[model samples]
Target: MNTTEIFLLAMLLIFTAPYLVWRFCKTDYFAPLVIVQIIGGIVLGPGVLGAAFPDYYQFVFTAPVVQSLNGIAWWGVMLFVMLAGMELDLKKVWQYRRESATTAGFALGVPLLFGCAAAMLLLGYQGWMGVKGKNWQFLLGIGMACAVTALPVLVLLMEKLDILRQPMGQRLLRYASLDDVAIWGVLAIILLDWERMGRQAGFLLAFAVLTPLFRRLMARLGEDDRWYVSLIWLALCGFGADWAGLHFMVGAFLAGVVMDAHWFEQRKLDMLFKHVLLVLMPVFFLSTGLRTKWDAGSYPVFFVAGLLLLASVGGKLAGAHLAGKMLKWKQGEASIIGWLLQTKGLIEIIFANILLDKQIITSDMFTALLLMAAASTMLTVPVVQPRLHRESHAGLMQQASS
Candidate 1:
């Protein structure tokens, strides 16, 4: 009907989905809750329900409402990324430095190389098949999409499964965290290259240099009831990055990492992020879901989607498994690690949406990538949990025998 009513309905659904999942399922199915909410949004939006009730769907998925929701969702993602960065224990990273470095390098490098190649081939095919955009741009977009991993989701899984404390798990987390930093750096460079060229690149260099100086100043701020100053500083980081044409999440993440070196107020900031994530992260996914326009009966699109899903899963598995073997890990452990690292959830969707908005990739490509991400995420828990559990048990028995 009206904008207010539409907003209220979306809000209501967002609040209710988690409750429904918690009541019915007890296995920490929060990701699936998000997936369901997105599907529900699509059904209730202009795709299905809109086909039957055109006026209502038109009003519901209006430009203003979508934009407002997108802004809220982005704020949610910023907090989420901050929390993800805070989850990193720098000491643990150092302790497992060699293994972590090897793993992270292999995990990131292999996927990026493969993704770039796959994008070239796949985008070429898409061009042949008469999809939009120049081949080079579409290929760049595809490469960018495939190269991303959902760092937040991976961290959450490690935390939820109590794996963060294990030796292998610690190594995985360290590498994944570092991999995220590298990916973001690459993304920043790419965005700057595409958007503002030389000026943006120069500003980013200055920001990098100034970030540490700012951190030192923040540290020197008196601890005599001056924590609110830190919040102001964090806000300034967000604002500055936004002004510099960088995503606010980048600023928020850097802020978390810099402050991570100092223990001051880390816990408080983390708790604040947790609260924000629980409420708002789903909204991000719901917005992504609302944008999903899957053609259930289109064989070409469906076939391409399935192929991409296979590539996403297989590519990660091959990369991680080979890396693990090189690091002299047991075969089973290496396989499981590969599978776990394959997860792609909200963060991947966020990146895909960004690329789509930039018109670097078409709607069909975005949908395919989204599907690939969701499928990969769903496969992680099932493939990883049993192996991790078995490893824990074996380690315990080995300790007892000793």
Candidate 2:
């Protein structure tokens, strides 16, 4: 088959396989379609499918076809990240400053400390650090990866749990928003290339100067025009960031972060986000899976993944429990909050991909992180549902008594 046909075939598989597994298996209660797609990507990757069927894997995922898929994945993730930035409610965080700060701080900090320790251990042994990775970059990158909260996926899961519009949901968003800012800021620090330092500094300076002008221009435009121009803006920012040696994803986030969410109609913005997830993100998931490697062997990767999961889950829970104590949250609140906050979804995968791209983390380490993220996300709903239900039941009983 020609390269175009092969690429189409690849696309067909990317969309169809995951949906079929998700729908037919009815994994929604435990794992959402997104999770299933992520699993599907890993399964289709070289480590799994390629090992099992080398010739077929090579035939379908030829160099040109893989490159095409990569192009799609890059744009898809950039747009996804941009939307995530746009979703940040800085104003709301400011409104609830004390609680947001306290929670977001613990939520990010504890995991980072734990993850850094894990990275140190991994680096003590062979085969974990990437080829070009320096010690600080690897440690910080891995540390921040543990601290990441997939705000977009958190929104989806909260919506699924029917708490997205609740007071609790809004509270979680505030915490996550603050962490999102920190996550990207830390990423810029880790990605800082001394050789390209001047270029990166220039980019930030230019971004600072242009951001307000961009906002003013956006505000003056009609809604339709704003939407169209935002895309143009996104592309330009992403290009500039990549050129500056900070990844395009950073620029994409910056592009959206400076804009007010109110500029776009909420419903339309939401629908477009959903459409992007449905149409484009699965390909990104697949590409992510393709990048996974078990160079140190599958068993070792799983073992390391288990260790990272322990750190991630334990640190998040500990941090939340501490915050709850300080804030005087009700009994059982911390566990649910912690588990929910521990979710490492698309954003974690994206972080891992960036690390891999920069060679700050090896493929084996990437695979481990991927598994950790998948496990953490899959655990969120199941763990949180029963607690939420019991809380609702108790609330109803108390209301009846009153």
Candidate 3:
């Protein structure tokens, strides 16, 4: 078939396979549709499908077809990241500053340290660090990736758990918001290119100077106008950041960060988020899968993924328990909180993709991170749902007794 036809075929597979697996298998309890799509991407990727059926993989995913898919994937992720930035509820975090800061800090910091140690151990070996990477950059990037929380995915899971509008869910959002900021800041640090330092510095300076002006303009515009102008703004910021060597997604995020949620109707924004996932993000996941490599060997990649999972889950839980103690949270609160916060999801995959793009981590490392991300996300709902049910039951029982 021709390139266009092949691209369409690839698209059909991308959308159909994951939904079928998710719906028919009824994996929603443990793994959501998003998780299943991610797994589907990996399965459909070069490492799995391509490795098994080289001729068919080559026929379907030719150079031109792959490039087209990447174009779609890039825009999809940029919009998704920007939406994530807009979703940050800083107002709520500020309202509960002490608890929010403490929990977010431990939640991010402990995993960082754990992940850094894991990176250190990998440093003594080979096939993990990228060719262009410095030891420090690799360590920090990997550590941050491990520490990172997928705020978008966390929001989805909370909604699924029926706590999205509840006090506890709001609290989790506050924590994730703060961590989101920290994660991106660390990414900028990791992406720092001294040779183009001037460009990056100028980008930040310009962003700082223009952010308020952008906000004022946005506030004055009608919603429809805001929607049109935000897309234009997203394009410009993405371009500027890419030109400055910081990557376009950073700019995409900054574009949305300054824009308040109140600026757009919440229902519309939520719907847009869902639609983006339904339509565009599966392409991103498939492209992400194509980038995966087992050059470091399959067994080793799986082993490292397991290690990262241990660090990620263990550190998140430990951090949550510590925060629970400090905040005097009720019994069992930490477990639920930790489990909720531990999910890495799409943001983690995006983070690893950026690292791979910049060559801070090898493709093997990227694969490991990807596997760890998928597992962490899949683990979230199953672990948290039962605990939340018990808590709800107990709350009802207590009210009856009272």
Per-candidate TM-scores read: 0.84, 0.99, 0.98
- Candidate 1 lowest-lDDT run of ten: 124-133
**Model 2 regions more than 4 Å off:** 295-297
lDDT of 3: 0.93
lDDT of each: 0.66, 0.93, 0.93
User: Which regions of candidate 3 fall more than 4 Å away from where they truly are?
Assistant: 295-297
> What are the clash counts of all predictions, listed in order?
0, 0, 0
Checking candidate 3 for backbone clashes, the offending pairs are none
Please identify which of the two predictions, 1 or 2, would achieve the higher lDDT against the true structure.
2
lDDT of 1 by residue, 1-402 (tens): 688888877677666855576457763443555455444444554445656777766666688888888888877776666666666667776787887778877776776666667666675454211233455555555555565667667766777677766776666777777777776676565445354555566656766787788667766776543356545656666666666666676676666665653545657665666677667876786677666664556455556666666666776777788777787777587777777777777667766766665556766666667767776777777778887788879979989999
